[model samples]
Structure formats: C-alpha cells, structure tokens
Target: MYVSVKGGEAAIDNAHRLLADRRRGDRSVPALTLDQIAEQLVLGVDRVMSEGSLYDRRLAALAIKQARGDLIEAIFLVRAYRTTLPRFGFAEPVDTGAMLVERRISACYKDLPGGQLLGPTFDYTHRLLDEALDGDPEVEPGETREGATEPVSRIADILGGEGLIEEEISGNDEPDDINQTPLEFPLSRAMRLQSLARGDEGFLLALGYSTQRGYARSHPFAGEIRIGEVEVEVFMPELGFAVPVGRVQLTECQMVNQFKGSAKVPPQFTRGYGLVFGQSERKAMAMALCDRALRAGELGEDIVAPAQDQEFVISHCDNVQATGFVEHLKLPHHVDFQAELGLVRTMRTQFEQAESAMENKEAAE
Candidate 1:
C-alpha cells in the first residue's frame, strides 16, 4: 500500500510535468501571454475574479493559464492565493449610481432617459465563427459614435417615483463578511448576497433556471442590466477621507418581480439585485433571479421550492466545498471498504447457517 502511494505520488508529479508541457505546447509557436489572456479572454478572467472575490486582472489571467482555461479551477487558484495576502482595511462601498455607463439597457422602458447604449454586446451578432480569427488576428480600430454622455437613469428609480416599487432603505448597518466568519442560517440579507457573489456560477445558474421552470415561480423581468467601470474608494482613517483606490469592471442586474398585495399591504413591484466584479451578465442575471426567489418569505410569497429554501441554496452553493467532498472519492478508502465488506460477509454467513439448520429440521420432521 505504501509502495502504491509512493507510485501514485510519483505519477502525480510526472502528470504535472506533462500538463505543463501540454499547456506550453510547441516551442515554435509563441506562448500566450498574461496580457493577451487578460484582453482576449476578458469574460473568463472576470468570472474568476468575481468568484474568487479578488479584482486583479493579471492574477486572474495567470490562474486561467495555469489551470489550462478551466474557469472553476482558475477560481480555486485565485481564491487560494487570496488567502495568503495580508488584509488591509476594507474599501469603502462603491457608488454604482455614479458608474461610467458603457452598456446600459432597460427592459421596462422602450427608450430610457439617455436612450439604450448597446456597448460591445453579442446580443445581435450571428453565432457563426469568423474564420479570420483562427490565424493571427489584426488589431483594428472599429467605428466609434458619440452618444449619451449623461448619466443613465435607473428603471427602478422611475418606478420608485410612482411608489410602484418597494421603498429602499439606506441603512448604515455594516454588512457581515461570511469569509471571515462561519455561516449560520437563516442568513442576513448582506450575508446572503455575499454568499451568492462568491457561490458557484453554474450552481446559481441552475437554481435560477429552476425558478423560471415554475419551481418558485417569481414572475421576473430584467428591469435593468448595466455593465461598466466603477471607481473604488478606500476610507483612510488618518486622512478622514475616502480616496480613490482603483477602478473595476462591474455587471449589475436589477430584476423586477410582480407581486400581489397581501391582506394588509398594497401590491408593488419587488426587486432582486446582483452585482459582480466583472463583465458577467448571465451570472449577474441568474444571481438576481435566485436572490429574489430566496427572498420569497420576506416578500410574503409562499416558499415552495429548493431555490426558496435558504439552507438548501446557501449551504450547497460553494464550489470549493462541493468539489473537495466529491473529489475525495478518488482517495484510498480501503479501511472503510473493508469494514463494510466484513459486515456484509458476516451477515451472509449467519443467513446461510440459519437456512441449513432449517433444512435439516425439515428433513428430520
């Protein structure tokens, strides 16, 4: 068994070496640089950064490359590296309202105040692959048009003016950090959002989809989905001022769900918000739906599905924990297997002896 373990360790080392060779491919072809990955595979890098809860684009790109483009693995790498870094003081909350709007669209209005600026979206593009991209691609400047430089108005704000939506409270309560503290249910709104932000994208996507398929049945509309860069500020204790730390690309989704009035309250449009660290629209949207569904109790809606269950959703959402447990099946469990084997064998022997005794008694009779 020790020999087998030693052999397995050696095999693992060799496998890593082989993987590194494969990741680099041939010497003749130039290796892909981190900058190239950061620029070209921006979406993937964004996902890794968002899930990893870190915003370093270069690190995200490096993780992606090291993981051989496996996004979940890349996320794991970034997250593991993040734990070793020293924690400086927390950054001040960003004001998304003041974001430099790149792509802002509202499903609620035909034309918003600034009009719809469809910036760099694949919404209308054909799904066919351009063969020109297979070879060395040329960097060319595309046509740029001047549009709304004015700050885009939010659809939720318009609804709020008419008292059609629930009132938003600007409370000064500090948000709980689940990363620092262990999780206990039922989670607070802040903790819920934090958990979802770092939760597995695919898991959230599936749960969000289940709601759409009549599981929880929150009639949702994408009120607004905005993608842009927001300036991050950190509060300096000594300076007594919040200074601009950096800028990060963000995808924010606000979903509006139709809700009927309860016995004591008037009907209004409810909201679910999703904000991620990078250009992740689908993830943002999925997160929004799941967020709303999780708030079914707060909204006075009946909780009828797994998505609505707080414990079910939050507990199984983390990919790292899930993957670790699932992959542990690959490890040696000979002792465990032997225990089960012995129990089964003992039971079988007892059954056989009892059957033989019964047969002898019948013959004598």
Candidate 2:
C-alpha cells in the first residue's frame, strides 16, 4: 500500500495551477479552437478516439486541447470520461464491403474490379517539407469523379470465391467485450482483435516491424486497405428492425499471409484483419500484422517470437496501463529508498572492517 505525502497539498495545488497556465501559453496569440483541432489535426484526434475506445470526434478534440496536444493524455482523459457514460445498446457489425470508398488500394493485385482510388494519400509525395505550408495559401481543389453507384467488391471475397484464401466464418455467438470482463489467457480471436484495436499504435507498429525483420515472419502482403465511411446501425427491440444511426469513418486492412498446409489441410492464403475508427491506415496495417503474428498456436506455427506470445502482447499493448505503471515511479518512495540506503551503508562498513582486519594480519605475519 502507498501512503500519500502530507504537507504537500499546497505544492500540488500550485503545480496544477502552473500546468493550466502553461497549457494556455501566451495569451497574445489566438487560442486554438476545437474545430481547428478536429479538422486540422485529424490524425491525432483519430488516434485518441481509437485508443480511448470512444467514438466522439468533438470530445476527442476537446481532450487533445485540454491535454495540450499529448495524445496519450488525451486518450486517458477520453477513457476516463467514457467510463461515466451509460451504454444504451451495441451497434450491429458494420458492413465494410458497402463502405463509401474514399481511398482503396491493394498490393496483391495491380488492377482489381474497383480500380485503385488514391484519395488524399502521401504515398507519392516527396518527403521534403513545403515552405508554402508555413504561410496561409489557397489550396487547389483535387479532381473528383462521380461516386460509385453500387457497392464495390472486396478483394478478400474475390480470393475466397476462387478458393485461394481461407474464408471468414460468421458465428451466432456474441463477441466478448474487454471493458465488461477481465482478459484471461487463451483468448478467443474476437477478444484478441478487440484488445489489438485499442492497443498502442507505437507498440503494435514495432511488433509489426519485427515480424518483417524475420522474427516470426509471415510472408505478408497487403491484400487490401480501404478507408471510407460505413453506416452504423443498431437493432431496435421496439421496431424489430435495425435502424441506421450514423456513418463513421473507418480504415479496414486485410493482410494475406503465406501458410503451409498440414496433412489434413491444403495450402492456402491466411488472413489478418484490422478495422479501426477514422482514417488510421498505419495503425490498421500494424494491427493486421500483429493480429496475424498472434495466431501462431491456432495456425499450428511455432511460437518462438515475442509477437507470437499472446499474454505478453495483450498485457503490455495497453498504453494506459503501461503509462500508469511507468509514471508512478516518479511518486515518492521515501520509506523504500531509506531502507535500501541503510542496508547498503551497513554492508559497506562491514566490507571495510573485513578488509582492514585482513591487511593487519598480513602485515603482522
């Protein structure tokens, strides 16, 4: 148990006040509005929402503003606020195949049914920083085409139809919610996906990178990455029908990994799925890699890498928990440190006495 340090209340209060003052820094400059943050720093807002497990863009912007641009702190604030809200009902599984495509690409196929739409991507851009961005300049409108009249076919579906890739089986069982129950080992694929969806982007990215470097390599290919708005629906008990609530922007990635079949099974492409809120392509791709890496046991692959360890990945992937444990070390540990210091001093004295006694005996002899 930890005891709070008394007599530091005034100091703590002052520190909080100072933090507020710093957050507001230089009143002469115009303060940033929530609209600017939500619209301009969209990626940051998306990250906070994804990790916080909350889907409020406005609230996420507010958290980013309050946390002074610290995405982790913004996520923590959003999560804390989320816990206070009551759940009305769960939404039905989103149909990504019908997503209003803003951007869609596949590394596996050069020309698919829905020709590649490179919408607002930095893939072809030179890495050099543009000096024009430092000044307010009129931005040129991008070329537009008529929106697709019908839903585009998913690449995974095409692959599955040809019997080239494993088909995803839909089940009647409701997936477990991590928020409602504690995570136990030997987690279901649904539970693992849930944990990874909200896992730290940096942590997942590193793990994903490690896999590419031959640590539990799963000869992966980005089968498809589509980003757009998907209609969300909730089943209404009163109406006996599902009603569309709203559309949420999502980035969905399907990674095709190589799998050598066993005696019973035939050689076919395996899949790693990632679906995240907003346009988080990097996060979605990273999630897919980690998701595939964690499937070692079920796939009958040797679990020799850290990424393959479900317990380690699931336990340490949460940035909130990791941050709390690491940051807590800054708190006072006076009693604990005092005991260690005393013990060390006693050992030093005993060692010195023993050394002196040996020298005297050697001289006398």
Candidate 3:
C-alpha cells in the first residue's frame, strides 16, 4: 500500500505534466489569446461567469483557457478564485425594464411595443460552418437605423393588467446569501433563484427538459427574453443616494406558464423569472423553467416531480460538489475494502461450519 501510494503520487505528477503539454498542443500554431477567447468565445465565458457567480470576463476567459474549454471545470476554477477576494459593497438590484436592450423577443405577443429586435441571434443562421471563419478576418459593421428606441412593456405585466396573469407582488425582505450561510429547508424564492443561477447549466437544462416532457406538466410560452446592458448601482449610506457602479450585459427570461384554478388561487398565468449574466439565452430560459418547477410548493401545486422537490434539485445542482464525490472514487480505498472483505469472509466461514455440523448430525442419526 505504501509503495502503491508513492507510485500513485509520481504517476499523478507525470499525468499533470502530460496534460499541460496536450493543452498547449502544436507549438507551431499560434496559441489562443485571452482577448480572442473573451471576444470570440463570449458565450463560453458567459456560462463560466454565470455559474461561477463572478462577472469578470477576463478571469472567466483565463479559467476557460486553463481548463482547456471544459466549461464546468472553468466555472470551478473561477469559483475557487472568487472565494479569496474581499467583499466590498453589494450592488443594488438592477432595473431590467430600463435596460438598453440589444435583443428583445416574445413568443406570447405578435407585436410588442418595441417590436422584436433580433439583434445578433444565430436563430436564422445555417448550421453549416463557413471555412472562411477558420482564419482571422476583418469584421465589417452592419448598417444601423436612425429611429429612437421605444419603451418596451413586459408581456406578463400586460397580461396581469387584464387579470389574465397572476399578480407578481414585490417583497421588501433582503435575500439570504447562500455562500455565507448553509442552505436550510423551506428556502425563499430569492435563495432558490440564486441557487439556480449558480447551478450547473447542464443539470438545470435537463431538469427543465423533464418538465417539458410531462414530468411536471406546464403550458409554457416565452413571455419575454431580453439581452441587454443594465446599470449596476450601489447605495451610499453617507450620501443617502444610489450611485452607478457600472453596466453589465445580462440575459433575462420570463416564462409564462398556464395554471389551473386551485382551492386557494384562480386560474391565471403564473410566470417564472430567470436573469443571468451575459448572452446566455438557453441557460436563462432553462433556469426560468426550473425556477417555475421549484415554485410548486409555494404555489400549492403537487410536488410529484424531481424538479418540484427543492431539496433534491438544489442538493445535486452544484457541479463542484457533484464532481468531487464522483472523481474521489479514483482515490485508494484499501481500508474500506479490507473491512468489506473481512465481513464477507466471516459470513462464508459461518455458513460452511453450519453445513458441516448438519452433515455430521445426519451421519450419527
């Protein structure tokens, strides 16, 4: 066992060196620059930033590079680095309504107030890759319109006004920081949202898919999805005013789900909300679905599905925790194996002795 441990240590060191070499394959080829990754692989960086709970694009890009494009690994790296940073001040809640929208679309309405500005979406693009994009090419800017943008109204709010949707009441309570405190049962909507925001995108995506597949029945329509830049503010107690800290690109998704009238509530459109960092439309939409599913208990709905169970979903959502438990199986378990072996051998010996005594008693008879 001691020899095996020493050999394992040497093997691990060699494996790390080999991995480093493979990560930097082909020395003749130009290495991927951080700027290129930040700009070109923006979506990858966005996922890392969103899941890591850190919004630094540069750091996210670096993590992506170090992890060799493994997004979950990159998220883990970013989170580990984020833990060491000192807390400054918390930013005030962002006003999504006043966002300078880059892309705004709705499946609920045909024509909204601002109209669907399909900005920079790959929805209409062909799936085939263009070989021309393989090499560095100068990007040409497209033509712009001169008309001023109009104020966009939320589809859910419009429905609520007409008594077609559930009333979304704002709460004055401050949200609990899950990072600072351990998660307890009966979590608030704010904590659930925070958990989902930092949750594994793939896990959330699968859970969201399960809801659509009749696991948790929901008639969902994209209420509104907007990708834009919103101002971040911090309240200065001394000045008694909120000051602008900076602007961050965000993707906000609102899923409008059909609800049946229950004993306590009327049949109205209940909405799910998802707000994530950067242009992650799919992740945000999936989060909205999962968020709505998790609200089953609060809404007095049946919790028959895995997605509806807060404890189940929240507990398994963290990739860092999931990965650690799964990967730890590779480590040596000699002590545990020895204990199991002893128990099995003892059971076998007892069975054989009992059989021998029965045979001898039969012979004597």
Estimate every model's Cα lDDT from 0 to 1. 0.89, 0.92, 0.89
Error of 3 at 56 (Å): 0.5
Which one wins on TM-score? Answer: 2
Q: Write the per-residue lDDT of candidate 2 for residues 104-168, one digit (tens) a residue.
A: 99999999997988988889999998999986799988876466535688999999999989879
Q: Please provide the root mean square deviation of candidate 1 (C-alpha atoms, Å).
A: 2.2
Candidate 2 — number of clashing residue pairs?
Answer: 0
TM-score for each of the candidates: 0.93, 0.96, 0.91
- Candidate 3 segments exceeding 4 Å error: 1-3, 7-12, 143-151, 345-365
TM accuracy, model 2 = 0.96
Go through the candidates in order and give the clash count of each.
0, 0, 0
Best lDDT goes to which candidate? 2
Could you tell which candidate, 1 or 2, scores higher by TM-score?
2
Clashing pairs in 1: none
Error of 3 at 321 (Å): 1.4
Q: What's the lDDT of the predicted structure labeled candidate 1? A: 0.89
> Residue 93 lDDT in model 2?
96
TM-score of 3: 0.91
Model 3 per-residue lDDT tens digits across residues 141-201: 8554343243467777789789998888788887899988789988888888999998888
RMSD list, candidates in order: 2.2, 1.8, 2.7
